[model samples]
Target: MIGIRSVVFDVGETLLDDTREWMAWADWLGVPSHTMSALVGAVVAQGRDNADALRLIRPGLDVAAERRAREAAGRGEQISEADLYPDVRPALAELRRRGLWVGIAGNQTARAAELLRALALPVDAVATSGEWSVAKPAPEFFARLIEWAPGAPEEIVYVGDHPANDIHPAKVAGLRAVLLRRGPLGYLAAEDPAATAAADWRVDSLADLPGLLSPR
Candidate 1:
């Protein structure tokens, strides 16, 4: 197997637990879980990427919108950083220790940095659609990540939970893509054959990441 020298991670399902965020959104919108869940499934079925999903939820869900949603739902506000995936920090630290350049590519607002800080999984670079105003599944995001890292795409692996957003675009950009199986939304990818085929690798937990990415 070719050795991977760098790694990029998808923020939502890959590195962070986004269920709380979605539930919070549902509460804010006064939509029931069942209702919002259906919408989420529909959004994914349409192959709408994460950015598209966010746009579909709220045309402009900026930091202010996020706060308002939480407050309206009677849920105390918390930064995105407060909701990181379990074992993410340790996994990231291990990857860095193994001499890999680490980056994060996601469709999040500037709050991504805050979340990373909260999770304590600081990476070498971060490329976000919110910052660039472009989303993934589009080659533009991956292309920008390549430019930001200035590393050979083959040497970099991108990890995400979504088949369309992470695996497809990462592979097209010449980067290996690892699918993380976590969160309720990822259940669809687990059951879908086509989605399963898109990933270069798959792990049930982020704790498996160090072993998966370690040079063989």
Candidate 2:
């Protein structure tokens, strides 16, 4: 394996806690938060994509319009810093201090990049699907990270919470993958040996990351 010189991350539950965002979606869809949670869980249990689950919940919904509305609302409302996980800043600082170039690449609305900037995350670069014109699990999305980071794909590590979105795609793109277990899909991935085995490293929290990626 090539030595790692850079690291990239998925934005959602990887760096930020998306519980409130999902709950907001539940409320906007007129469903109870628990009901929405159950549906998301069921979707994962069956090894189905979350998009399929959203379709099952509300077929024919105009997602793009809804996203636009959400972004507009976000612009007016201040997103709390508490939405970020406690370990994010320290872990990122440790990685950067160790000379690893850090970046963020994820599936998010156009506003997410602005939000991250507003939140003052200490990443070197940030790219969202909205900006890149492609989303994760897509070769283009992972490919963009290579363009943004300082090293070759094999010399980079991509870390995130989702098995399919973060780990699998990064591996397919020729980068090492590390699964951070804290998102909605993380539990399902953790229980599936095939998913866990696909990653080069699996840690319960970002706090475990810096040491795992430390130079040997």
**Which candidate ranks first by lDDT, i.e. highest?**
2
In candidate 1 the C-alpha lDDT for residue 183 amounts to: 59
Predicted candidate 2 versus true structure: per-residue lDDT over 73-153, tens digit per residue = 763222468888899999988888888888888888667777777776777888889888999889988877888888888
Tell me the tens digit of each residue's lDDT in model 1 across 1-216: 568888888887777766777676677767787766777767776756433444566677574566655567677435454577658777887888878888877877665555555554656776677787778778888888877764588878888888777787888899887877775446677777776787777789877877777553
Residue 129, candidate 1: Cα error in Å is 1.2
Model 2, position 92, has a per-residue lDDT of 89
Pairs that collide, model 2: none
Per-prediction TM-score to the true structure, in the order listed: 0.79, 0.90
Runs in model 2 deviating more than 4 A are 71-79
TM-score of 2: 0.90
- For model 1, the stretches where C-alpha displacement exceeds 4 angstroms are 45-77, 80-82
